[model samples]
Target: MSGYVRPGNSQPALLFPFIAGVVVVLSVLPLVRLAMTGLSALAAGGAISVLADRALWAAAYYTLVTALWGTLISVAIGAFFAFVLTLTDIPGKGPLGFLFVLPMMIPPQVTALAWVQMSGPSSPLLKALGMAPPLGSPQPLYSAGGIALLYGVQHAPLVYLALRAGLMSVPRDGVEAALLSGASPFRTFRDIVLPLALPGMIAGAAIAFVSCIGNFGIPAILGIPASIYTLSTLIFTKFSAFTDRTFGEVALLSGIIALISVVGLAVQERALGRRDYRIAGQAGARATFSIGGWKFIFLPLLAVLLFFMLVAPFLALLAGSLVPAYGVPLTFQTLSFHAFEEVLLRQTITRTAFANSLFLATVTALGLLALSVLAGYVLSRRRDAAASLVASLIEIPYALPGIVVAVAFILVFAAPLPVFNVTLYGTIWIILIAYFASFFAVSLKPVVSAYRQLDPALEEAARLAGAGFFTRLKDILVPLIAPAAGASVILVFLIACNELTVSALLWSTGTQTLGVVIYNLDDSGSSDVASALSVLVVMMVVIMMLLLEGMAKHLPAGVVPWRS
Candidate 1:
């Protein structure tokens, strides 16, 4: 499993120690503290209080039910796109894939807000179209089904990404051989492709379930109003209403969330672990099946999907932004930019949020880029259980929900530090540290994948010529992996800039982020301003994605995730 490392070319002496230190600080320490806190709470009879509460059981049940349903929806939508885009002659695959993945990148609360504005009684867009329901009518999205639907929408891209990776690895030779044996396209797909792709499907489902269970934004926005509480939102509510037991109780709650996520991951492992689904082939999978005239049907189907998933809600958000008030209709005469003015100019909090978010994102991206490069190099070269364990540790913080990570960090940093006695509990520094811990996995993956593809002979040769480790990396490795590194930086920046759940809990007055600002605007009855802000954020996301799309040509395949 090692990369092209030549023997006798040892890694830098301090590399392993540095990586381990980072893992311990970012991943292991906070989680260990969380577990300890929860165990302590249980030992102190907090378990009796927590376990005996009907609310806790209800929240857990709701979380599992919604996550399961969301996983099913995600798999269905994601599988359809994965199969079509990877295996068939679909037109505009690149653009379609990119658009389909956009919903996932857009914050879940934003998606929920946009959808809420697109329907129901108070929908400005719907009201303008003379299609809104009566004022007292309940919001269609403020229910359990609504939460599940939005969860699916927000997470389907994950499934698409996971399944598409496996689908891309399907053997072209196997497909061709099956065709030569007179197996029809349908038979070949069902008999060979289906079985081979099952692992990917299962893995995607597992990931979707974890994501859904840990999702705070969707459930917090949709479920809470309807009296449907998921574990994530329940944790938020508990924190919102602070108490003496808040820390310990939240620790227990976070443990539950972590336990559920771990089980899902474990199931994924068990499913993929038992099988050696390796195949022999010269060429990777390609679009072997041409749908021909059926593209007519499929094209419209895809267009409709995109319309609902991206176009309609965005239009509603735009319309809501233009309206003078929440329920006001948008027209040439009534269109207003007051909301934009309020968010971009008048609101000091919003301005502070923008600055804080940009600062955090830039720092986090650059910081992780540096660490990921070092870690990636070491990980790619070292084929040992220790390296694997380190990689998994890096993944733990990321795999758990952002809220859970935030809680863990809070527990770890709530007190003043040892020598400095400086506190990070209510500062931007804590948020930055959490971002490093949470998004390290994102920054490292592409770099590691790029590193694996590199030829090790150059580095070895350079080392033999008396070049030091940094010198060899600068001369040989850096230039070759520049594109992937650039992609990693931008990807982390995009994610960090819009992150809410982590910052939501971590932010004090001055450290508000874009995500928190938007959520706050809407919650404070300034839907128009929120919509306006969401519009800008959505624009930012689109621009970032387009930048990545432009870089897709130069970057390694799969490094730009939305690209095929």
Candidate 2:
């Protein structure tokens, strides 16, 4: 029925070709390649060899345990912030929300590095404060628990965003009616608000779980040192020890990661399968509970969490960068600019990484913007089965782990091109192609939202006057959605610039990205240089966030993450 129904606008036919192209390049080709490789490996007994390895099973167990624990922690911290910030009158909410989300925007490896600097017997910050652990004491964060903790801190904002939407939708009349009926605050929440918000919480948990499973940076840095391997890191290690069976082995691992991610989504769907999330009236002002005495306590509680989440780790990272060596104290006499000087000026690799990351990010952001604008227009205007399929295809590449996408691209381009005989297997072009596939969803979301908010009458009027598709799009659609388009560009640019997992597998000599560079620097026992580079990366992320924050008022709701 949907397939036959006329779409909302005169430009309905344009959607098919455009959406088909994206689906082919990003979703259909890569995923098909991955499945074929894995299934072929199984048929050829390549997987049997991998199955016999005890480390594979051990990594699977550790991945599940840590991801489960991390999801719980994320739900707890994220729900608390979502409830307090959205429902109650929290002071400095703008600042609080911004700082709370910084962990997500910052690179996962950087978060790992910061927390590493903040603790441990080897920390300069700890040594300077005269609070160093005893000699030869193991770093506590190298365990499964430590890795899970960082996973929670990194993904908590996802839960906050998801839950806040459901909370915002609760009918004001319903809340007031419950209050007038003499229901206690706790009782009302348990009976009325909690049921409606459950779906959001479940969805958020699923997202957090998938994120934890796909995460490469956190586990690679923290888990590898202690010999605690997750599925993601296990794949990286397989690449490092390249053999004739390397392709088949990594494909099997990617399949396992994909299965784990699908299971997380399936669990969420099962939990929410039969529930109705609708509230029957307009959402007015949210009901405010009066608790004069609790503010004094709650405010302080919030402040402490914010401090540990944001300030402490950053301060630790700053201290690490200032010291001349890894374990050296940061006294005025010992502090030096040598690390910064080396990363910025002396290391040719560092400069090349910066340039490559910037170039790729810029190209991906700008290129995706052009395609997404057209794709978003079609998706928002057309209501059909094909459109739905197109959307799912777009999401598959982004939703799965970056490592999976990287592997898929590698398999697809491993050989020279058929016609031109050009090789992209070990070039910057392969990485660029992977980025386009990965970040399509990020660039499309805001634009689709923008398109939905517009009335079709403007375009219809243009059509009636004999104006063509391109003319109407330029005059009617583009102007209406420009703010959101800007948001999309900035969001994609920031993410692409700091990405590592995809690049880690794909980068060759002279093509290393910022993420690959940072990971390598730390791995090579140059953490002082790593810290210095990380500080610069963190500063760049902050600047981009501030730019979006300044444009928040003009953009549509939910376009700027920190804004209400």
Candidate 3:
């Protein structure tokens, strides 16, 4: 056993800290430059204003209102679904559960484009039902309400996943005792289930709120047509449409939004600290409640919701992608693979964007995997205040909206500051850095969670037996936690591959990514090409998810303690 102890205390453990220090420096270097340049401009009496304009304020207000409303609706619907699935004997529960999870696999922009096609008056189903209207008419597909609907539908699955996990883990004995004590089903759920699942529910809601607040694609595609704007769109307009140069005022607004998101997340974490519900032993004897007449009603209701939310949007996108024209009736004559051919051959930009997105995603995922593993190891083993602080700060980027980070990067890198005199604008490295920061929190979560399950005594035993840190990490921790790390890496890559908002704002002529290219085509009235690109993105993500699933199957038994 002593022979298993790792040697070289300082050097091996130093690797992660060294790498983390370098990454942190790289991340902050641009911000430092921005502060210096902004200050210098102010001192010279030629500084651009840092306060947001009235348009920006209006946009921010719209964004906040929609996000709040969307979050509330999502939480309520998600909780309802969770309760139904967990407590009631609803028919097709298994299939319904699977269907509810399908939304997460589809990208938001794809869903928006699909809804646009479906809401069109010339759509086949609408025509078949004799409900087709004139060429131009008011539609829910082109308003803030439509954007909120899209967001809620897209994010409800996330909340369901969280709440379902929480609910399934709840002790049945508690609920059973409540029922035996003359509690009604509703009372038992309110007092026993709701309180127990609140932490996960809150976590899910927070995630949804933050995601909805920062999302740009749905609002841009669906909201812009109805003359609605959000903070993300306003930032895009300020940076791209209003002027070629970045505005300090827009940056300030972005910063403020980002700050609010950060504060909200911090407050949430503090309020919920160490309150997580965990089951220490086997959950013996599950209890089920009969829904009586309500089951028949709910089963169809769920089916209709799934049809409208999941099936309709995807089918519409498929129809639109195949149709030659948007408003034209969907007939066999109009349907063709012409859009796909154009996307493949005529659109070099689309192909180039795909390649760039793949490259950046691959790099960012690998970088995040390596960085998070090391950081998690340090945090888990060291248990120092500094490490704890670093752990907390890692979450800041998750709360900060992508558009905000993009604007901040522009402010910092468009000018020279301190040791970094080169402008990184229009470079792929800038995009990679931004993505890395945006997704670091995602990568960190699973790894940290996995690390927490590991016993530090195992490492200490190896160290005492003369094995080095790298050897111990390699032969022990790596093999043990590899599955969690891989899952985190793949998830991060998938997100990066599908990310649009920040990429739309920051992508330049030479650095056009898939998301940017698709948006540009959509903005320039090339909906077919954009639809084709969206299909390709969705396909890529699907492939990655399948691969991840396969890889997960091969992971060692003890790799994912949470799963066990």
Best by TM-score: 2
C-alpha lDDT values of all predictions: 0.90, 0.90, 0.73
Model 1, 249-294: lDDT tens per residue? 9999999999999999998999899977777785565626878998
Off by over 4 Å in 3: 1-13, 26-52, 88-95, 122-131, 241-245, 266-295, 416-422, 455-465, 549-564
Residue 354 shift from truth in candidate 1, angstroms: 0.3
Better-scoring candidate (lDDT), 2 or 3: 2
Which regions of candidate 2 fall more than 4 Å away from where they truly are? 1-9, 12-15
Worst 10 residues of 3 by lDDT: 555-564
CA RMSD of each candidate after superposition: 2.9, 2.6, 4.1
- What lDDT tens digits, residue by residue, belong to model 3 across residues 422-523? 677788877888888788888877777778888877887986797776788789888878878888878888888878877876788778987777777877
| Deviation (Å) of 483 in candidate 3 | 1.7
Error of 3 at 55 (Å): 1.0
Model 1 spans > 4 angstroms off: 1-10, 274-278
